[model samples]
Target: MTSRMKPAIDIIDQRVRHAMRQVTGIEDCSAIVTPATNAKFGDYQANGAMALAKKMKTNPRKLAEQVIEKLDVSDVCQPPEIAGPGFINLRLKPEFVIESLRQMHSDPARLSIPPAEKPRKTVVDYSSPNIAKQMHVGHLRSTILGDAICRMLEFMNHKVIRQNHIGDWGTQFGKVILALWHVCMAIDVHKKSYFKNDFERLQSNKDNKNELYKICMQIRDRHDKDYINDQLEEFGDAKKYFGRFLEKLDDIIDEIWPDILLAYRFVNLLDDILPGMGLRIITREKKDNEWKPVERPYEHLTRKITVMLQQGGEENCQEEDAWHSVKKATMEHCDYIYQLLNVTLEHPRDSRGESFYKDMLAGVVEDLQKQGLAVDSDGAVCVFPEGFKNKEGDPLPFIIKKSDGAYLYATTDLAALRYRVDELKARRIIYVTDSRQKLHFDMLFAVARKAGWARDDVELSHVTFGSVLGEDGTPLKTRSGENIKLRELLDEAIGRARSVVEQKNPDLSEDQKQQIAKAVGIGAVKYADYSNNRTSDYIFSFDKMLAMDGNTAPYMQYAYARIKSIQRKAEKSGVDVEAELKDLTGIEFTQPDEIALAKYLIRYGEAVEMALADYRPNFLTNYLYELTQKFSGFYTNCPVIKAPPDSRRQRLLLCELTAGVIKHCLRELLGIEVVEQM
Candidate 1:
């Protein structure tokens, strides 16, 4: 394997630290080399000498001079200068900058950056959407953020396993299956549009309790009748209607998503309203190999069905089939959003949902019990990981199984963690979720460690992010206070971008405009999110994100397009631009803008390292934004296409390298598309 190239800053830090070790006869001293705070100081500064002086109780400036005597950075930086308080300021030589640029230009794929020295098998769990529900704005952060992390890790040559831990099993699936049955009966049996009509009516009359109650009663009565009648069929409705419906489900799968959503709402409405209305529904249970009818409260039907699905027998095959169909359809919908966002999550391959660990939940709880880490607390199986407490100053219980014999998220997560570690051999497991789940994961990791499921050497991280807020500083939602569906949000972004593209460059072809619009629209959304501190809430503003200025995606993308335009213009004027850059022997920087841009270009690796250090993408975004600003200064101050013959090739090289870095960062690392034209 080829050795990875260390960043210029890393090389400098090594050299400076070695010099410090030689001067003070102390090993393991870090130079703490950082970029110069002010441009006038130099490109970088070593502040370790002052700290070392403090440790040695000596004059700082005098210690700095001694360290500089042993520093041999003449090959990379000019002679080091001692600044105030013993800061060692170093400036990169022009030859060094040129050589770095040449290395980047020669290797367009990686830009001369190599993989890590020791790579580990890593698993990233993110974008976990529930079965039978459309992905909403709430999932946007985890989906894209996790994808970016995976891309960065893969770029560093780590063994990355992208796990889409979808919510495929739970109490919710029972309701989802019930909703599917309603859809089937509404279309195949009654042959009416009751689900859609009732959903709209329920929404409009939600504030009117009397009217809502009346509607719910009417729907409840019909549902009861249908349930009783369906059970009359041989082998119940499980084999009669639902099984056949599942057989041809794919034929109308695309058309049923809307119906399924409406039906789900219908079921939820009934569950909320008909609870205390003295409603009863007839369901069945198989006892002694004979079917027996039982009366149950209408509102609790879904829960009863959930118990049946969990118990899983020959009698509940229909419920199991329905569960599978719903999960499949939901993931198919999620895949569409994944493609639109350029995320890498796919079904079956990367998707390992809660259902995958359904059988293991009991074993997880049992093993914890055997280890004495889990105990019965208030009739529920719980693990009281140390340091977690409630407001009453009692140890908070991390509930694994409810008193009703139902496993919760904590149980499923434990199973998944064990599988990732023991089966997948993952050295590091990262769970990307919102900040609200911090306590859950803290206890989870603690319990896993206590149970010896995840060893101390195995790295487990819960990467949390703040919610995306609307202009009102609340979580982003629709006007109706519903979670905004991601598909609709992305489509609106592209639509708005199209209008902007139309206003800016109307002469472009329709296809060209569309391509640019999609790139700009989606890129703006992802970039805006990535540019913000992951732990801070940011307002989702399409107008600001789409603006052609500042640190937005449009600005960075436009910077890239402008560079490509320069190359195109050069090519049109009978200039063999590639040939000229390839034939160049050396670059002499005569302009301040050239030097500034060249210096920032070589620090791309440092930016990557910083971003990866804390798993904060804002660092890399901040770097790209500054690089674009530097390139703008260079472009304005020094003309690339019309420069004098002696400097034209140098300027052209700078433009090419700038474009390459921007494209690689945006398209490859950030998963955002870059266009060649506005």
Candidate 2:
């Protein structure tokens, strides 16, 4: 089979293609084969005749019947029937459906899905939060959605690059640097006053020349020592690698002045790394009147991170190692998202941000200008391309420089693009960003094409998405004027998830609660964003997402959980699932719900392929939700426990298969967890 054609899929395609050719005498008519909008009809339906009815000079019902007479789908489907208003309803043979599911089960990949014909290298930019700030709700949607997109693309065999693109450098850095400088200055002033007069008076009261000399020497020695430089370098190396330990130090002699001050400064700065860098600081006040201790801000921050990371809800680790563990723990957290989402991630590359490209930005601009694709207008370099116009009907330019000759976002983006295309030899550059920057991206893609940095074969696409709005219909927010933080939002979601799981499945142990919370919380948030059309804005709704019915993550998860519960009972009873798989039988799909459920399950590969082509998870999400609903109806109507052995085995197998499909879809499409019970 060609990569595009699976056995069952090809059978359906051939049936439609043949019907179009025979009835319309036109081979290229657009024929849509979709699940029946309402399940009252057969398993699948094609509405190709509705549009063709006008052109063919015949009634839609008559044309559909004529088309159905010429169609051949015996290999994978029952003969087509003409339904109401020109709909070609299709029914799959139950034995055939069972065989298709069996074939999918036998395949190691579980869906019989194949990779793209031409897999190309692609770059995905996502989850780019600024350093030293908490990762807030402002960043949550993009991080989860973009990561899931990249994961899906890679899972389908594309060479994907995950770019964190942290905002490590900017004018903001200058602000932070100024902040740190003032803090250091104040601490130094306090240290100087404590040492000068206080030490001299202590020495005067002692009164022997030798004792005074010793005191002077001790004070002199203390002021000249430095241990912080060694500590900083050690911290950097440990965080970078997954190593057991950095070399430990034994106590040498005690010193008083310089060492203490230097250590204090380093500790103060390290406290800022908590929310993002994954570190904690703990401190206690000094009882001595002359020596006041620093407050334990780091410890509090570490506790917050620890609560998120530790399985048992404990926030205890070695102070020196807690920083490294938190960093490791954050990565573990990111990985759980990947696992739940069922996508692979590239080894993360820390290339920093726009300022990291400073050395190359100027050169890129010069090259664009030299190629005649860019020009200086009002002291700013811009690219004017064809067809794009402003509201005033003037040609719009993608700015590379501002009026002050400062580099702009477009320029940095172009430089990054050029580096990826020319230097990295990338075949594709897929940018995943918010849809508001559509014009910016369109301009960049056009200018890059004009500048000879990219070609049509080297794909450059901006996978733009809509804003995540709140219930108020603007953008999401708390009652507070400030933008809701990602960390805070996640915490709230997890807290709610914990309560939901506890109430629903109170029998789960503490460990299960923690694990399920991570899955449910993150899954609910991700599914809320991904389940809708990505190009359109979706209002964020916690209650709706966590609800037990209709196109929600929990509903999908609950389906899987119910199936798992059945499978577990079967296993406990020592039922031989594989041995129960039998060959020939009377095709027994009497119920419409059974037929509907079977049809949805068989289209698994097609849904994945559609999602892969469009880079839209909603396609798959919609498919899975329908599949779950159909299964739910089937389960309610068809009793499994009281059925005969052969039928019970078949039902169990069907349940097992449905669960597998749901698990795969949830991870691949929405990045959620499947609770065994709930």
Candidate 3:
């Protein structure tokens, strides 16, 4: 007696393989058993005979018949049919399907899908938004996609380490630090509108380069004068006061994220206005038991700050404090988004971003150079990985370091790769990012492979996804052409769902309405993205995803709700669903709908395995959609509560299993929530 339900496909696959091996004397023969391409063929088609016959230089149909002569699937499948070109098709016996389902009902936790025979540790890198910046629509695919991959892998018993390789370090972050400094000044001594005024001026003059440059320089001057005047002694002090303020930043993160965003934007505006304009800011450095003033260029201030923060010392105390402060605020923002999206990227543990690799970057490059994989190109340290070339056919260089000593993203990525391999013991590393970064990852992976950073057996995959587009079929953006904020999009989704809920089912309580609206809204958004082929661009449509029909999340959720509602009605009308399903030994399916639903329900594991193999969630979503449709048909044909004794037990079991499968698919696997009621 098996402890868990074994999928009928697996049984048929094994039986067919045994039969083929017995006849052919090929002990290690494979039965390429897959779900039939279409229903006309059968439930599963074993195409291994064709491949074996081709390999053995024999007639395929002859080989199929020879293998079929010894095939003993009498208990599980009907007589095997050798279709065109030795395709051995096997259809499950109705009793076998019912028995397989009975086995599944014994253990509900695993849902009949056994853990992988050999599990490996996997590192899933995804959902990496920049620090001090609001998450945008661009992060939608990677976050949920990566999370789903993790869920699937973990479900398969693999040790999954989720790495949210966020853009928390680099030039943008340096600018964010500068912005935080302004926040510090504004809070401590300057007028409340000081940053506000500068930010507005910066925004207004964005198009006028000359005007923007002038304003940036003026802002820099004002900042310099303010630092000088902010003195406790005759010679003004900058670092001492700033360091103290940094220490107290944690208490104010909630109050200042909006300001942080504005300040970060201001930094971008400044960088835009003056591409390489030289300006300087004073930071405090303690030497010989004295607090002394140290100056860094305005253009390179952030870089210098980043290096110091990365390097970690008494000189970088304030910068480190500010860095941690900014990270805390940004993580809080991301947590909200994660909660809304149902992603499981936990903080502190799963999050290892670019900043985490900052210190190791130089070492990664140094090791590559030592191994002769990286070499000096012009003035930058570069690895010209083979097969990559420019439009002119020149060997493209993956620059690790600039002549000015700044580390590139390639350097940090390489560092992260090495860390994942060595420390995490990751046998497989999956990077989830936009398709635009495909080339970068290609170069990075090639360089890592050349440098012996990754083992030969290790699987390094970059799961690239396409962009989310708007109604006009362009990348999703606001009317002002700015990237749509994720938070705003979520709010709009919920608002739209509320409107829908009001129109569709207005009698529910306010709390129930809100609950349904949130589940439907967010689920719709995620399902729309999941339903898309990750490699193809998709138009994000609220009306379409939110529709309570088709292959949408709302549709799946509503179907689950309908099942639960029926179950509730069954109980209310004196039907003991649990008792009826307490024993599945005598269950019988009289209706075609029941048979179809049972067949589809058992394929859930197959869907999970397929999605995990390709990192494609659509495979799972498509399976769920089909399963729900099957359930709908079954619900219509066989009544659970009102059916005759022979049918009622079987129908109730189907309802329970359908609801379980839907919940697992939506909430557990895809990170989409479902409500009990509409």
Candidate 4:
């Protein structure tokens, strides 16, 4: 199936394995073929022979020689070499390298990253932002990394289902909804920007410890009064007004969306500061089989709302209505962020938040219990998957249902895994999240395997990434130690890029400058992240990312733009680049630079294979960076426009292929936009 489009490494691996079978009479043999660790050894090195020899009790070098005796890779590679420890080094013949490029050049649509022979339904769960908070700097890595993975997988013809898995249903919603009620009351009855004033004061005094404490105390006092007075409803009082306000919530949405988010943050901050504050808020309870006022603990108020909303019924109509309204508005907020980030996540379509799996949480616990995979531990439904234990040396419980009958993330996640398998028919689920969730996912996969929800054929992976740190080696945050909003971070990046663009190319039209800045700025942020090791913490530096000299988005964009400018120059000088290469006979690797560039250019598909094999974008980025570096050497050594017709045509082919590779890696695979000018 992959005879035409299989990557170079795959082709080599197959040939080596086939030859190994002929030599050793083994039906299947591991080739362990990989790109050579160093170019001097050759283009590829087959290290599997050593392990196979150890297994069969044969000398590895002897085995390598025997395998080479029958290996039929001469059409593609030079004569294989036996190196140290029986390493069989294979270098492609120049003709094969040139032929590979010709294939990619002829079909720019694929860029040689052909569709997978056997496509699988893959679910990539990522960027699960909390509904109560704005998207922050902490969310940057997962969002972009996840997007790139989805892009790369989809490019390879995998049916990728992007699940946002947003944090929509939880006790946090209680805080936000309760806070929202105050926002409704403050404006409707008090006729004042109640939280607005306190919010401003808090922000203004965020750094002054004593002043901040005083402001917080005052705000808490007012908050207490507002929450308490709602129960003192004398027909025209706060409770009745709350009911009327909920009725009109749809109309006041636009006016309250911004303030509601701030108020929600205020509630979260207050909840953090005042621990075990047994204070209660007024809400409705079913008494005499009718809804009536009831007081609940401030801390548990969020829980009440969550339970009520999750257990949807006529009794919890108001609670459900309120949640739906807030959830809808939050979707708008997330949609705005997605648009600003150039992300492909659609609002409701891609969003399969925790709430979406609410109804299935209980059934998940029940089914696991029925299958003898889940049991009650301390009144909580738990699956004690093997290989996990607590500090007490007891098996750790993956609590699906808490003692209070409330479901945790584990329950919803299990439900999601099942849905993706049974309904979505997903053969692989790639979870993109921070490293902190590593233990959780390990337990999750273990439980799924134990329950037989995911079969042996189904792939479950936790693509964990490290934090995006500041230059100080701490998590990037605002001056007040709060999370820096993703919007502000991206806006600042674009602005910084704008200054660079205007300064470097003031002659570019204003629209063009903005377009370039947007590309450079956003591309810089994404590329900087992509260029780093995904499993290691990386410091986010605007200056470093926006710099034109380093392995950054701007650098890559500028390099691409430089090559594009050459094409423009060529056309302006009446030289058609396409025509020069359209009927070109052959490429001449005259100079060392030309040969090096050509060698790297022909390995584009190999780079794609490596990156997608392990789901690492950095490999692809590294390849593009090296390709550009090699092209720089080639551009300096080999004159395209001024050289003789033969050399000029060869250089032009390099330019065209190099440009195509960069554009594919950046725009197609990484979701990064490129510019035609710096």
Top candidate by lDDT:
1
Local distance difference test, each candidate = 0.88, 0.63, 0.84, 0.83
Off by over 4 Å in 2: 1-10, 18-27, 49-70, 83-87, 169-173, 179-347, 350-352, 582-587
TM-scores, each model vs. reference: 0.95, 0.73, 0.91, 0.93
Off by over 4 Å in 4: 1-3, 196-239, 277-284, 288-296
Tens-digit lDDT track for model 4 on 1-678?
Answer: 222456778889999999888888888799999889998998899988898899999999999999899999988899999999899999988888777777777888786666887989899999899885778988888988898899888888899999999998767766777777778777876887677777677667656767766666666566566655664333322455576777888787777888788888776666664445445555567667655766666556567766766676754466566677787887787788787677788889999998888889889989999999899898888999999999999999999988877889999899999999999999999999999999999999999999999999899999989999989999988777889998899899999999988888889899999998888888888899999989999999998988878688877777788889888888888898888878655775768898888878877887887888888899999998898889888878777788888887888888898999899889988888988887
lDDT of 1 at 175: 83
RMSD of each: 2.2, 13.7, 3.1, 3.0
List where candidate 3 sits over 4 angstroms from the true fold: 14-31, 51-57, 187-192, 220-224, 227-237, 240-244, 276-301, 307-312
Q: How well does candidate 4 match the true structure in TM-score terms?
A: 0.93
Number of the candidate with higher TM-score, 2 or 3 = 3
The candidate with the higher TM-score, 1 or 2, is 1
Better of 2 and 3 by lDDT: 3
Backbone collisions counted per model? 0, 8, 1, 1
Query: For candidate 2, lDDT tens digit of each residue in 487-531?
Result: 567667788989988997899899888878777876788888878
**Candidate 4 residue pairs in clash (backbone atoms < 3 Å):** 174-302
Query: Could you give candidate 3's per-residue lDDT for residues 1-678 as a string of tens digits?
Result: 456544667777788889888878889999999989999998999999999999899999999999899888899888889999899988888887887677667667778789898999999999999888889998888898899999999998999999998888766766877788777777777758487888788777667767877887788788777777655653334554565677888887888778878877776766666556666667565578677877877766667655555566654555776788789888888988998887998787778889888878778878888888889988989989999999999999999987767787888898999999998899999999999999999998898888888868799999999999999999999986788999999999999999989998999999999998899899899999999899999998998998877999888988889988988998998887888788777766767898899988888888888898899999999999899888888877777777787777788888888888889888888888889988
lDDT of 1 at 488: 95
The predicted structure with the larger lDDT, 1 or 2, is 1
Q: Ranking under TM-score, best-scoring first?
A: 1, 4, 3, 2
